[model samples]
Target: MKYLKPWRSDGGGLLHLTILLSLAGLRLDLDLDLCLLLPPPTLLRDELLLGCDPTSPAYALSPYPAPGGWGRADQLHPKGREADPAAPPEGQLLREVRALGVPFIPRTRVDAWLVHRVAAGDADGAHGLLGAAAASSAGGVGAGVDGGSQAAPGGGGDPRASPSSPLAARQEEKAPAEQTARVPDADGRASEENEVLRERHEAVDHSSQHEENEQRVSAQEEKSLQQKNEDENKTADKPDWEAEKTTESRNERHLNGTDTSFSMEDLFQLLSSSQPENSVEGISLGDIPALPGSSNDGMNSSAHYNVNFSQAISHDVNLHEAMLLCPDNTFRRDPVVRTSQPQEPFLQLNSHTTNAEQSLPVANLTAFLPFVDNQMRNLTSEDFLHDLNINIFDEINLMSLATGDLDAMEVSQLFQEPDSDSGLSLNSSHNSTSITKSNTSHSICEEGATGYSSDPESLPHHNLEGAVGGNYPAPMGHRSDSGFCGDLAFQHVFHNHTYHLEPRALESNSESFSWPEKPEKMSRYLSDTERNLSRDERRAKALRIPFSVDEIVRMPVDSFNSMLSRHYLTDLQVSLIRDIRRRGKNKVAAQNCRRRKMDIILNLEEDVCNLQAKKETLKRERAQCNKAINIMKQKLHHLYHDVFSRLRDDEGRPVNPNQYALQYSHDGSVLIVPKELVTSGHKKENRKRKREGIEDGFH
Candidate 1:
């Protein structure tokens, strides 16, 4: 398995999971399907039966021998000295199929997939499918036992079967003599026993060649079979009698001779020869055990299995052609012939096919999509509240941050346990008038490593928090990002205004205070509305203005005048009220002005970006058009020269391209004009340019 480290600052590793099983000592291979690469199936199709027994060439290319078995990825031995001298070069092959450098099985995915197939097991189908194919040969070997057995136990493609060194032959000749001596045959019958063994060995050697002929095949036969299938597909309605006769003659010769390109149909013929019995062979998935839902009843059973080509071709027009995907991802007219060890089924890629997706031209889907306009997006005070999405309830115990309406609270509690009865709270509201009149500014820098940070605010609490003492606990929850809106607070900053509700102002509500006009409920109203009052609210209250801030700010000019006439306020009170109303209106107007200014700037930026992208696209298109125009002009020049050279004017002389020009008439005819006319047109354009220049100078 391959691993790539995380490319993020937060350290972590991406993991791939794979299971390596030793179930029943079978090495399983999974067949990959083209459709599985797309979305629909969600997994590989189970019908593409897996190949078995690793190919000799497949292992010869591996970097190192796999430690466990054939399916595992090779790993280097921890120690240098641990090496197997007898291991063949074929033990270390690393083979994989790929398309345009993309491995069919991603290197990062689990090595093999088979977990979803079998029940009451580790559920890898690699071996189950392998066993099913072997079941065919096993049945053949069982029935053919009477005919005579010749296959060696180590299986086909074993290096030991090949003829090699004379020294190995000498050892083989002397091995029985040594064995007989070790066995202590006191009856002295070793010579007679050796002769009997020699005769039996000779018969066994001769028998294997004939047996191997039944399965072994040459590539030419596979090629002919594919061609025959293609020819049949092309001539479905009108059969090619000559080609059919040729294929039949070739097949008869192949069966009569030694060479064979193993076909499933042939294998079943040699196994269960009856036509009706072989009909069920492929439908049974190479004799693999039936799944619970699959019907085991012979005829009905095939309804659950895919049609097996090995047992049931039935002269279908293009059935063989449907077996393999072509380069264009469509099925070809003939299946690719694959080869394997006579004892073990294996797989190979068809040398013929090419991938369709790689070859086809594709268009960009999003090229024509329209751009979005985000210029008018707004940041409201409600927007600021929702930015945090904070639910500030009495029970929640959230810190009031100092960045805005909420405290980016540098400190939640200002004092530690000085006394059980004493405590301190951090609040930044400007409502208190006399506790500490030191006006402080809070930082709104809003830029840093976390995309947010603040410079210190000039607060009286900083001095007091030192006089008192406390440390902080770890912060809770995700940090909320709120970009400071400095525009709304500009009026207060510019005017150096502080809106404070003084305790002495509310003292008028106490019974001891004199209210010569009437004993009115003043403090009750103030208490209920105090928390939500605006800066204008505080100013109106300080001046003892008789209306709410909203009424003062929103009242029309005529209505405001009527309100003033109704109230018998002093000159100082009236002036203060007018100043308050003017400042409030101007403040709102300024904020709108600023918001609109920023919006216009943002819209201009977006416009510039879109126009720049369009400019680049147009530049490329213009270059392409210019190239096309030049090519067309060159062609037209050649055509014009050829036409002029072939033309004769009145005296049977050829016309010259440089001296004459052709112009089309309105009535579908061509006329020749002298080259001097082109020169006159050019002179006229020069005069027009000069005239335009003189006109611009006068302007």
Candidate 2:
């Protein structure tokens, strides 16, 4: 609300309150909008609360003792002292307890944070001072620090113990420049170690909200939280009299001596207290849900990493299903073969049917299946002109032959040529001959891969692999783009797989991964998330491959070959990945070829029906033309007689209608020629040929 007050006027008279998060003494303020993306119940919180041992690190912040004990050996303590109902108040403390005996959070705040730092394993004088404060019988902090009977539990005399509140700030002003060194790494800068383990179990979340906190506090907060700790440590190293004066000052401020009451004995007493009984409702008194950016999730500097494992790839020995990927990536529990072996056939000794050995084992037969299937599919002819789009039902095609999709265009073209010449007075016989020849030629030529490529090398570089692997290959035909994509699905059922892999990681059976200090690095340690990444990607990461998998899958063959030439790959790597390009292209080519063949067959069938219809139409048109020609001949005969009757030639007689006929020459000249003249020439030629044949025989 305070930050929003100034922005209210600027934001269209509206105000927005931001939520704040603190982690490892880092303040982060986040906008309300980001809450949508970040979910709750993260693993980091669970690990920080439940995983760390308090004495191990400087930040194992289990500050307050457990309900019954500081540690229960996780309820496995041997003496069973906490469970003894008659033991003492301490033993009964864990049973039916509603409140803690002490005020854990104080109203008159001191530098109790210093005590927590000491508990966290800081080796400075803070621990001894705190111990002295704890031995005070007054059940208060200042009562003992003011030269009371309390002494350090470790035999070190009490060091200076000052108030943690604003009282310590006064001493901080008088400190020399040398003792006031600022804390290193207080700039919220992430280090190299932070980059490796981006997601960890105990990382202190420095989410976007945290970044906002830095911005908000940049002006008001001069000393960082770490620097404050360092300054308090310096103030604690003061002389005993200074400590006494500090205690007096706190008394003047009216803060009671309550902070001094806790000690090592208190911790042991708390641990030995009775524990609460379990509830069927599964309720725990200790559950405090932390928000996404809270310190409880990832406050540790050294966050522990949990490893991720991959499912084992399985191989099936069944011949029928061998080519298919397994439903489970791991092996199934089934036996090797499905049915019992057939009994061997018996053979007779003489002139009888002999039995061959029992059929070869299934495993041996499995090897040949792929080869046989490939050969059968390869029998399909290439479809080179498959992609061109044409109207399969053109009117011209229907008028032509009964050709299907492929031959429709050729038939239509032939029909068009004949129609253009039909207007000429050419005889009907000449037109029929040309149409028959065109149809015959369209079907016979240009059949297979041989027509497209002379050798197998031209057919998508099939024969070239061995040749290219061994030596430089000859230049080949243009490459066809035969790439195809299939649905890529990978499933990992969580049951029986999650817990199964955890023990190996705990046992450190796999290779160790370095932990980066960044909070995001926590995801790297989560097996569930890691399992979702690409299997091949994980494989490449594991292999430390220099190039990306996408590049290997997407680049052209020539470019891929060039890349291979650039790097020296192992034989296993070369063989394993060699078929990636071939398989992808072949899948696409098969789809294209299948489509083309179907189109050709369909068009041919259509064209065949179309040509039959045209045949009927042509027959009708030929009958009409023949009838018209006969009518014209009859008209000519009547006109000839009429003209002869009206003739007034030099003899005034009608021309001999039967002897003479009208003829037309190529030069467009009209001539009257005797019909007998034409007949006499044909007859004389035939007689001359017969006479010549007889003369040649006589010779």
Candidate 3:
């Protein structure tokens, strides 16, 4: 199936630009779009598939001629049909060929042997096919001859003989004769027919083998083609592959006139070069309009830029200049007084007014009004817009922020006017010195009466202790006076407390006027009752310790019971005491346990030593016992030999009546006799022998 298809890409923008450039000879504005439409060369395509298998055709053949306009054949060419049986080579005549046509001429020749070799996929098949195709296309007559053997035969004419003849006349004369020679002679014709039949049979067999090879080759190629189709279909079905295809198609459509192949750098260079050559034609800094007043043209007034406070731009000629020059008078209008009747009010000053005087407190509400209105509108309509108000005072307490916890007198000096020497002067002429002396006298008098020691330097200690006095029990002899702050004094104190003063107040006050250095003396103005609790008040007072031993002990138990009932003890506490023994004698138990362990260690050591000693004693005793037993056995054997010798008369046998006696000890030691003697002897004799055995064994 030879199908021809043409692929054309429409060049909308790029084509127009390229055509314009070609016609006009302009060197400007060439982007990748022009580059993209240039068709690929044939060498590129040929190189792409030069090694590709003909049997496995992965791509369709190109319909266009190769770049050089060369006629190109693909590896994936369609198979040829079989030739007629009347043809000399039968299946060997692969396909009818016609070129410079004549009767009995072979079609475009492809070596039958070579084609068979290629079909069979012989080792040299590709080389053979290339050689044959090259030879046949080169118009070699040798390639057309059967088996390429015509040039070798004796019947061959000149090697370069032309096909159209001087031979034509000779062939014409012989044609008639050749026809007449076919008239039958029965035996001769039969023999010629037999030889022709035999040659035809050999050619038929060759053709048959070639057909078989072709069929096998075709089957292989067909199988490969089917597999390739299946693989392509599978790839097309895959999700990523389909996505890639769609993306590629979309890109092809989008960048129809533009090339997507250009890199960022290349595109940038192209864009920069494509820009207009002249600065005038291009956008430049100089072309930008200057600021309103900066322009030299008097007609181009700055009026449009003169914005009033209400945010509206003014077009009044002088107003714009005045706004720039006199910003203070732009928004504030002069108050105008209107007279009721035609009568004019008396002039306040001599008549010296001018044209400029008529324009007083120039009122222009246009500059910032729009901005304010916009802010208000934004707050009203948009949820995102918030009108946030922060009261800075609430974040920090002003009084505590200003007047820190310090003695007022010490703080007052920090805000006071220093002497010429820059040191606090003790001169009584100064109101500050007099005030300090009064406070000192007052403090001393109070301390003397209350039997409390007062120190000028201990004021800070007093203040800290006093702040804690109401919570702590009264100490020593001092007691709080209930009438200390009477109604009038309380009112003064209340007013003082209400009118919060800052430490910096004195500084500001000093800047306004001089301040007394001794602020404490001002407190001395109070009555003795009001001044009852001085700095030494706590020291002068008595405190009865509320916490008794019983209370302390009861508190822990109560707290413990409450905690246990409420399950209030934290995990840390539980872990700490979980393993504590409730009734153990702590110190004694630990000491005794340590002692007992030491005792056990000593006992174990002694026991181990005793066991080793016992083992040694047993071994020594065993050796001694063996020696004694051996000696006793030897004595018994000697006694037996002497007795036997006495009984026998120079013979080793017993001749007289044999008697054996065994003596016993006086202490009634029982004896053991040997089994032979015990069974044979009488009862009395056996008893006597047992007693004697005991005595003899002991010896």
The lDDT per prediction is: 0.26, 0.24, 0.25
Error of 3 at 486 (Å): 25
Report the Cα lDDT for candidate 2. Answer: 0.24
Best by TM-score: 1
Q: Model 1, range 1-699, lDDT digits (tens) per residue?
A: 001001100000101000000000000101111101111122122111222123221111111122321111111111111121211121111122121121122111011111111111323232232222211111111111111112212111112112332322433455456544443222222221222122212222222222222112112223334444454444333334544444344333432343354443344343344223222233223222222112342212223234443212211111111122111222232232222111111111211112222111111101100100010011012221121111111001111111011111222121111111111112223213211332122112211110110101112122111111111100111111110111111111110100010122112211111111111322332334443455445434433456776777799999999988766553333544676788889999999999999999999999999999999999999999999999999999898888898888899888887898887767999878888986797699799999999999999
Candidate 2 lDDT tens digits, 1-699: 000110110110010111111111122111111111011222122112211232221111111111221111111111111111111122122221213222121100111222122224432332222221111111111111212112112211122222231212322343234123422132111110111011111112223223343333321121221123242344346654454344234322321222333221222233223222211011110110112322322122101001000000000011112211112211111111111100000000000001112111222222323332232123212110010000100111111111111122222222222111111111123234322323222211111111111111111111111111111111111111110000000000000011112222222211111111222542434255444544333333222233555666678879988977665442212332343344445656888899999999999999999999999999999999999999999998888777656654468667776777666677999566788876786599799999999999999
Candidate 1 runs further than 4 Å off: 1-533, 568-572, 599-628, 648-699
Cα miss at 77, model 3 (Å)? 99
- The TM-scores of all predictions, comma-separated, are 0.21, 0.21, 0.15
The worst-scoring run of ten residues by lDDT in candidate 2 lies at 483-492
Candidate 1 displacement at residue 693 in angstroms:
13
Better of 2 and 3 by lDDT: 3
